[model samples]
Every structure is written in C-alpha cells, then in structure tokens.
Target chain A: MKYLEDIGSYFLMLRRTFSGFTKADVLRELIFKEINDLVMSSLGIVSFIGFFVGGVITLQTALNLTDPIIPKELIAYATRQSIILEFAPTFISIIMAGKVGSFITSSIGSMRVTEQIDALEVMGINSLNYLVFPKVIALLTYPFLIAIAMFLGIFGGLIAGVYGGFISLDEFIRGLQEDFIPFHLVYAFVKTYVFAFILATVPAWHGYYMKGGALEVGKASTKSFVWTSVLIILANYIITQLLLS
Target chain B: MIEVENLKMRFGSEEILKGISTVFEQGKTNLIIGQSGSGKSVMLKCLIGLLKPEAGIISYHNKPTQEMNLNQQRMLREEIGMLFQGGALFDSMTIEENIMFPLRMFSNQSRSEMLLRVNEVLSRVNLDGVNTKFPAEISGGMQKRVSIARAIVNNPKYLFCDEPNSGLDPKTATVIDNLIQRITHENNITTIVVTHDMNSVMEIGERINFLKNGLLVWNGTQEDIFKTKNEDVTDFVYSSNLFKKIRDVQNS
Candidate 1:
C-alpha cells in the first residue's frame, strides 16, 4: 500500500510539474543554471570513470581470449560493444543517479525544510514547476553527455589496447569499424533520453515531499539515489526488451 | 481586514486548531500569542492559506478564500506577504535579488525600476548597503529585516509573520517588532503575527488574540492585557519574573 501511494504521488507530482508554467525568462535562467550544475559540472567525473572503465574492459577481453585462433582485433570489438551498449549509457547513468540524484534531493529537500518551497507557494508561484521543470529540461542534454562519454570510452580503449599489448593500433581500429550497427547507437540514445527524465523527476519527488529537518534531507537523498537507480535499471531492462530483443 | 470564522485544522488524528475564530484589523499589528503546542502557529498557517482548515471561512477584504477562482487566488496570494520564523530567505540569492524576486515575478517593472524599489524597501527596513551579501553573511536580525523587506517589496495588502522574533536578542526582537508595526501602520496593511514573546506582545501588539489549546481564550489590546482579569491570559503573560514585576509596578 505504501508503494502504491508513492507511485500515485509520483504521478501527481509530475502533473503539477507540467502545469502552471513559470514565465519563459525565469525558466530560461533556471534551465541555464541547471545545465551548468547538472551537465557541465559532471564532465570531469564522467570522463574519468568512462576512460578507466573502458580500459579495464579492453584488458579483461584481451586476457580472456588466450587462443591464437581468436583474432586480436576482437579485443577492441568487445570493448567498443560493451562501452556503447551498456557501460557508457547505463553505467554512467547509474553513477549520475548517485551524483546528480543526491544533489537534486538534498538541495530541494533543504528548501523544503527551510520553508523556501512554502515561501514560493505562498507567493503564488507554482513551486513544482519553478523547481523541477528546469531540471527536467536541462537534462535534455543528457544524451549529449553520453555521446561525449562514448567518444572518450572508445578512445581510452584504443590507447589501452595498443599500449597494454592487447592489440596493434591498426587492428584495434579495424575491429571498431568491423561490425558497427547504426541501430545500436540509436538504441543507446533512446535509453539515455529515458534515463535522463527519470533522473530529474525521481529525485525531485523524494526531495519535494520530504518532511523533517537536515537529517531527513540526508536520508531523502539516500532514498532518492536508491529509487532512481532501481527505476533506471528497471527501465533499462524494459527498453532493451522492447527495442533490442 | 482579515476575518477567520470557526477555523479548524488537524493532523491525522490530532486536532491542532479547534474552531478558533478571530478578526485581524487593518493598519494594526494584530498578534496571536500562546505557548508552544497551543495552536498559534497552526492558526497562522490556516489564516495564510498554507494549511486549509478542516472547517472555516477565511475572508480577505470580505471575499472568502475558498470561493476565489484560480486567477483570484493567484491575485490574492500576490497581495499577501509572509515573514517566516527562520527568515526563510533564499540562500542562493543576494539580498537585492531576494527583495526583487516578487516584483520580477508579478510586475511589469523594468530591471532598473525593480532595483529602485528593492533599494527603497531595503532602506525602509534600515538594512542599507548590504544588497550584495547572501543571507548567510548577515546576522539573524538582518536576515529577518531582509525577509521583511522582501515581504513588503511588492507592497502586499496583507502581511503574516510567524514567530518573527524567535531567534533574535531582546533588543533586536524589539526592533523587528517596531519595524513590523511601523510597516503595518505606514501601508495600512492588515498584519497578523504569531508569537509568544511578551516583549513583542507588549510592544507592538495593537490587537492581541491569546490562544490556549487550540481555543482563543482572550481577545483585547495591549492596554487591556494588564487590566483584564482572565486567568489564562494573566498566567501566560506574567509567567516571567520580569513581566510579573512590571505588572506589580503597574498595580502599585
């Protein structure tokens, strides 16, 4: 029953977020700020994680395939496939579910605790639209960030493959181009876009409705991360089943 | 003027406001005073439309709140200003931006015009030349002043303050009380303040409503506070040694 209530409340919050739009100027400023906070600020950590994880994938693939019959180019092929299909999109989103999700929850939850949200409402502002809509719009840049992660991941794989003696540079390049499917990129982006919406709204729900003081803000952040990750994983499974399987 | 009739509020099984009704006059510092858990805050919230009463009529300028259409509700809310107990200033914004917020949202004033009005209110609150400072950089009293500045920046017709003196020193609290009183008188705005501070009650409580356990036990003015023989009002008002001494001196 509690789960059902949360689900119902989540949908209600979404409805409120979509209705009673703020002025375009205010929304534009908020969106710009969110883009800077959610997308731009996240670049360093995402790139670092993408590069190291891609390199690890390459080394593992190279070590596992000990048979000479298996061409060395297969190392790059495996790395590229893993990074594009799952690592860059799904894993990076999970990481963001921790980083950005906690941030959204804590910030909004603090506002709730401090009566800032109430203040907004008391002033005739649609608090949900004012607070959450910008976040959702800013996260439209999520696919773009994932694209950067994809580039760096493959680049990291190339460097690791050549330097770690996993495969020659030319061979790795050939493998990257060997079985490239246009649809795979499309599939990844579709999932990225879906995950992006989940990222913005799920954490917002936890924070906006949270009760209590500072300690409750921390607790809401943790709960937001858990629920966001769970929803993302579930959505990933459902999307993969519908689009790829 | 604001009038509340038979206002009742509850939290699940717990009743917070038990059909309390009172009138807060225009151009006066109307006060709601009670001990903690006496439903003073709950009554204030209900009056402000932040919490809907389970039963009652809250009429602003003779228009019932529940009967107002969406646009009317918006317009009504715009005409109302609130000062929270904790100041509730947006931490991310500087004092100037905080003061300019309501104008930016609801007015057609240009940037220069908004800044002028913001400056006027800042000066009105006696908080000049700290516009660039964030809420955290200022003292609690200054933050309360900023909150008041923001509340009145749009020139609201009604003002509600919840424990406006909660964290300030006695001296600063008196200053805030006087400031609120002056603002109310100057604008002829209907102001309602919820507080338990005897200093605030004695200083600017032009009309005072005393609540005890969700019921309004006494209604009178500052002069009447001393002359009235209401037991609850006497007990609550003279609970402190300082006020008791003052009361004794007055009698003597």
Candidate 2:
C-alpha cells in the first residue's frame, strides 16, 4: 500500500513539474546549467565505457564462432548489432542511472535538506518546475550522447576486429552494411528518448520529496539508482517487444 | 502586520500546533520562544505558508491568505522574505548571486541594478565586498548575515527567521539578534523569529509569544516576561541557572 501511494505521488510530482513552469529567462539559464552538469560531464565515461564494451563483445563473438561453417564477417555483424541495439542505448543509460541519476538525486536531496526548496516556495516560485523541468529539457540532448556512444562502440569494435585478425577490415565493413535496417536506428532512438525521460524524472521524484537529513539523502540516491535501473530494463523489454516483435 | 488566528497543524495522529492565534506587529521583532518540540517552529512555518495549518486564518495586512488567488498569492509571497535556520543560502551560488536570486526572479531590473541592490543589502548587513565568496567559505554568522541580506534585498513587507542564532556562539548570536532587530525597525517590516534562545528572547524580543506543547501559553513584551507570574513562561525562559540567578537577584 505504501509503495502504491509512493508511485501515485511520483506521478503527481511529475504533473506538477510540467505545469507552473518557471519564467523563460530563468528556465533557459537552468537548462543550460543542467546540460553542462548532466550531459557534457558524462561524455568521457560514456565514450570510454562504450569503446571497451564494444571491443569485448567483438572478441567474444569471434571466439565463439569456432566452427569452420561460421563466417568471420558474422563477428562484425554481431558487434554492430550489440553495440547499436543494446549497448549504446540501454547499457549506457544504466551506467548513467548510476552516475547522473545519483547526482540528480543527491543534489536535489541536499537542497531539500537545507531548506532551499522551502525558500523558493516562500518566494512564490514553483520549486518543482524550477528544479526538475530544466533537467527534463536538458536531457533532450541525451539521444545525442547515445549517438556518440554508438559511434565509439562501433569504432572500438572495428579496431578490435581488423587488427586482432578476427576479420579483415574489408569483410568487417561489408558485414556492417549487410542486412542493415534503418528502422533499427529509429527503434533505438525511441527507446533512448524514453530512457532519457526516466533518467531525468525518476531521480528528481526521489530527491525532491525526500525527508530527513544527510544520511537520508544518501539513502534516497541509492534507491533512485536502483529504481531507475529497474525501470530502464523493464522499459527496454517493453520497447523491444513492441518495436521488434 | 501579520495576524494568525486559531491556527492548528498536525502530522498523522500527533498534533503539533493547537489553535495558535497571535499578531506580529510591524517594525518590531516578534519572538516565538519555547522549549524543544513546543511548536514554535511549526507556528512560524504555518505563518510563512511553508506548512498548511489544519485550521486557521493567516492574514497579511488585512488580507486572508487563503482567499488570495494565484497572482495575489504570488504578489504576497514576493513581498515576504525568509531567513532559514541554516542560512539556507544556495550552496552553488556566490553571496552576490544568492542575494540577487529573488530580485532576478521577480524584478525586471537589469543586471547592474540587481548587483547594486545586492551590494547595498550586503553593506547594510555589515558585509561589504565579499560578493564572489561562497557560503561555505564564510563563517556561520556571516552566512546568517548573507541570508539576512538576501531576505531584505527585495525590500519585503514581512520577514521570517527560523532560529536565526541557533548554531552561533553567544557574541555572534547577539550580533545576529541585533542585526535582525535593526533591519526590522529600519524597514518597518513585520519580523517574526522562532527561537528558544533566552538571550535572543531578552535582547530583541520586542513582543514575545511563548508556546508549550502546541499551545500559546503566554504572549507579552520582554519586560512583561521578567515580571509575569506565568509558570510555563518562567520555567522555560529561566531554565538556565544563570537566568534563574539573574531573576533571583532582580527579585531581591
């Protein structure tokens, strides 16, 4: 019953966050700051993680195709599909659920603890819109990050496949081009957009309504990460079922 | 002036404020003092609209708060300022930015004008030329002053402070108390402070309201406090041995 009530409150918070928007000038400033904090700051980790994970997937695929009947080009095909379909959009979002999600939760949770939200309210500002809406707007840049992740992941796989002698560079390029469907990219981006919204809002709900002191702020951050990751995985299954099936 | 009538607030099954009615006069330092868990802070929160009373009318300048429309409520809030217990300065902003926040949100003034107002308030609080310094870089007392500066930079019609001197030393607390009182007088704003500090109660408590277990047990001036036969007020106010000695010496 408590869990159901919390879920209800979370939706209500989101409703309030979308309405009673802050002034355009203040919102513009907030959105810029959030973009800097949430997206620009996460680029390095995303790129590095994307590259290594892509390389590992390619190596594993090559090793597993031990039968002579299996074409070497299949290694590149597997790497491309894994990186584009799942690794970039889904895995990177989970990583951000840990990194960026915790940041959103802890920062807003601290503000709650310190009464800054109350100050905003006392000043007649919509605290939810002022705090959370900017984050939602700024995360519109999230798919761009996923695009970079896709590029880096495929690039890393190319390096591993060609140089490690798993497949020739020409065959790998051909393999990447073979049976490619543009709809897959569309599906990945659709999933990315949904995950981005979750990434912005779920942590915000946890942080904004959190009570108690510093210890509770830390606890809310952990809970936010857990919930965000759970939702992302769940959403991934749902999206894939709807889009692919 | 701010008037609260028959205010009541509760959390679940436990009632925190039980029918508190009081008036905080303009140009005076109104102190709400009581022991811990006596609903002093709860009353202040209700007055500031941070917490909604289960029953009551909170009026500012003859207008009931509940009757105000959204725009009216925003206008009323714009005319009010608050200094939280921990100063509550935005940690990410510098002193200047913190002071300029409300102004930026409400006023159409240019950046230079906002900066000018911020600096003027900073100077009024006896904190000059520390615009770029963050809240963490300053002392707690200075942070409180910065909060005061922020609270008044918009020239509010009312000011609220929650335990303005809680974490400060004796001397610093007195400085804070004096600063708040002076600012209240200078602006002719209705200022309400929630605290249990006896020093604050005696120094700047022009009008004092004493609460005990969610009820307003006593209300009077500081002079009235020293002479009153009210057992609850005396017990809480003279709880310290030093205050008791002073009271005894005065009686003798």
Off by more than 4 A, model 1? none
Backbone clash count, each prediction separately: 0, 0
Measured against the true two-chain complex, the DockQ scores of the candidates, in the order shown, are 0.88, 0.90
Clashing pairs in 2: none
Q: Per-residue lDDT of A129-195 in model 2, one digit per residue for the tens? A: 9999999999999999999999989899989888898899998998898889999999999999999
TM-score of each: 0.99, 0.99
Docking class of 2: high
What overall lDDT goes with each candidate model? 0.94, 0.93
Candidate 1's residue-wise lDDT over B1-252, tens digit each?
998999999999998888888889999999999899999988888887788889999999899999999999999999999999998899999999999999989999999999999999999999889999999999999999999999999999999999999989999999999999999999999999999999999889999999999999999999999889999999998999998898789779
Q: CA RMSD for every model?
A: 0.9, 0.9
